[model samples]
Target chain A: MAVTRETLLAFLSKKTRADLSKIEDGAELFSSGVVDSFVMVDLMMWLEKQTGARLNPADVNLDNFDSVQRILAYAASRAR
Target chain B: MSGKPGIVVLGSPRSGTTLLRRLLDAHPNIACPPETYLLSAAARFLHADQFAAGLRIGVLDGLSFAGFEEAEVLARLRGLTFGFLRDYAERVGKPRWAEKTAFDAFHLAEIRRLCEGHVKFICIQRHGLDVAVSLRDLVDKTGGYVQELHDYVRRYPEPLEAMARAWIDTATAIAELADSSEDAISLRYEDLSADPAAQMQRVFEFLDEPWDDELVGRALAGTGQVGFGDWKTYARSSVDRSSVDRWRSLPEPVQVKLAQICNPTLERLGYARIESDDDEDDADAARRRYEFGLLLNRMKNEDS
Candidate 1:
């Protein structure tokens, strides 16, 4: 099952309690203080379930998971 | 003139050594460097099985072959290591130096010989369960101190069990050292954090140093944050009881496991064994603890 952008956005929106419209697909989450590292751990775990692969600690960096676009790319790469 | 008896602070990692180091460093007569691993390294060289593979001899024998007698080796090693610390003290206009290093408890006999019987140890012990919890959180979050913990991990495999074993081993070493040596003193982390001034005064009395409110204030202020130790101390201004029994927030299973691993040593050290029977809310409590730990990390990052 592919992780849809909308689904990821919905998860982030619920975690941040922000409107879906406020968060950009390309906007930085942790770097911008929009989402904390704790939420990032939750998101990584959620992504692991969605992607069916254990996310490598090396791959779990700010550059890869800072935005929805980057996270989706990471998930898609793992799916491949 | 022969130097004064040296002070060495011994404790397992995360057992409030950082707070203790800063407090000792604050004293006008003593200079305590942050997280000096020199003593542990000295202990290793003296006791560890280091062989010269090609030469088919022990490393100490090889050193002997290379014209360094065991006594001379220790004398030089002590001079070279503690020499730097003494210089650090003098540079700062202090007369004495103390070193707080991890794993220093494991080889107290060697440390005693290395320091040529002119050393005093202040061993700090904390509750075993709380130490396991703190060690787990520290490894999970920062990926720091892995090298120091790797040997225990290899033996125990289970992370909490490894941490519990570390706490037990350190406490046992400290107890034996205190029993065998007159210069060694032990203190509890709970008591120190709860009433820092009183505990510090006791420490001063043990050291035969002058003590007063002014020294205690400087220690509590904890100004210098130089070397590699306890990033948390850099955020807080003074020690508090906030971290005394952190194991209570962890799941019952974890508490029980840690308690079981170190109960004998814990009881020996006057810490009550944990009685965690509540099972219904273990999962909920663990989740809350996890989130709280994360929130704390976030807050600390923000503060710094």
Candidate 2:
């Protein structure tokens, strides 16, 4: 169940109106103005459901969920 | 007065003020500028000269002063600020003008002095913890550093408490100034969320405007272009009512520090002292606090 970049991108695409093509794997979501606080909750819920992983506030750091690639990586790590 | 009544919607950030502003703006007779912060910034300038330097560029159009009489400068500044608001309103094609600004809550005296008999104030209140959670969510979504968020909480302390204490403080302070002024009303975010139509009708009544059901309905339906885009994936299905006590959800040490810092104001606003097991009493005290506020308003009117 290793999450791939395409799967993460598709999930994000389905959830938001953002142009995912512009969202680079390493770009900062907040600095890039691609997301805001209200959307973060929805994203977390979607991720939890999709990957069957529970995320706590402490777990909500840049390493695991900064961008699509990072999210996929985080999900893959959890799956392993 | 040459036009419809001017309204000032005041609250702390993330207190549902923006949503309320949009709702009020939906009224055909009303127009609001986004977070003008004129009076608030002026207060900060009066207290701290350094802030004036930064604010002059963004808000004061590069205005300068080289040691003029403080009172005279403030008076002149007030006039300039009011002029800006009035002119903006005129340009917007609406006779009634409103401004939604957070810092304005901290500058009640200046607001009263400037607007005087001219403007009405709408105070919007949301639970402070909810606001903090919202702020946390915002910082996370925006990819702000956790360290920065921790720093802000450490600096502002009680002023940053999520429940409506700051809103209540500002409203109470303004209410004190607005005694017999006939130009201030307080609205709760919970009531509005529970029943928008009823709450809106009350808002219109308080503002002395005719209620338009259709306009209110449209505003409720219109989320605007906000909270869209990539962020939409992160939207919470609904705000967590229980999150109002999110300070409890923080690490024990963080919660202890926040409680210690916030206890005095929290007690002043009728929040229970945040011991480990004060949840039920805290909620009750919060409810009583708002009830006393309504009572205070009634008592003031009776005295008047």
Candidate 3:
């Protein structure tokens, strides 16, 4: 039930100090300056907290966490 | 204004980014500084805020910043990277700034987003064969290549295969950016050598700079050679077409291997394929298409 789109957006909005509605679901968060490497590490930690699963090094790339939608999908796969 | 006309110059290593950097840095109103591990370093450090703090206090070499507490520096390079660049421009009284990085092709989205609004990217490319030859020279000369390239060279049985793989990866990454980004455009090294001034005009126009044919022409003729010293040499003031086809001097089978691995990309980039024979095209075209499809599939496997 965790790692929903809203949860990710909330986490991002808190980290970036930008309005939640400002960033599109599909917008690349890192590229768009919403997250940096530090925030990315925090994001992974957040995902693991939600899914109770560790992300393999291979699973961590720009593709997985590039956007809010991709992060949700990636977290869901791990949750399953 | 427009954030000092920020630019990110990127492409395959040795594919003329350094050459472009040299030329752009010569501009009176521009400051195109050397590379830093802004992206890759960011990837490694978990506490980006701490890392940024560490960097500000000069933690990279394991030192502390004098004024700010070690814990006080912010964690976001994406937020502060352009700010630093703008600061540098202001200090130098320049109105423009750029960074030349071979790795930016992989981080294009991050760069576009970070520099948002006023950024433009100039991605330059060269023939893959030439790139392979140059990379091989670098590996031989330096006893190492970039880490990503080290894997390809060490993993492949044939060095040419590895170089081909590197070239394709670099070219494809840049291609995807060219296909997708409105703020990015590609240029050919060949054309630049053939005519530096004209090519520079195109670049300047794209960058919204007042074209100074005299400045560009003078820089190319000899004034820009700073104390690059141990860096051996860089682009000369005059166009040197000698390196353009130097890869042809590579052994025949090696040339064939490069063509097999790189010719499609080369063609797409508008360079002529290395044609050994003219009359065999019909048969070769059919076979190359099939072979290219297989190569692409193999590439997908490798990527995944």
Order candidates by TM-score, high to low: 1, 3, 2
For candidate 2, report its TM-score: 0.52
lDDT of 1 by residue, B160-179 (tens): 88888888887787777776
Q: Model 3 over residues B153-246: C-alpha lDDT tens digits?
A: 7878677678778888878777777777788777888887778778888888888778776765555554444532114335355556677777
By lDDT, highest first, what's the ranking? Answer: 1, 3, 2
lDDT of 2 by residue, B94-210 (tens): 677777775566666656655656677787655555555566566567674333244445655543453334434554564455445567776666666677678888888998788
Model 2: lDDT of residue B127: 51
* Fnat of candidate 1: 0.00
What lDDT does each candidate get? 0.76, 0.58, 0.66
For candidate 3 chain A, the 10 contiguous residues with the lowest summed lDDT are: A36-45
Instruction: Give the per-residue lDDT digits (tens) of candidate 1, residues A8-72.
Output: 88787765557765567798777788886555655765676688886664565656777788988
Top model by DockQ, which number?
A: 1
Candidate 3 C-alpha error for residue B125, in Å: 1.1
Q: Is candidate 1 or candidate 2 better by TM-score?
A: 1
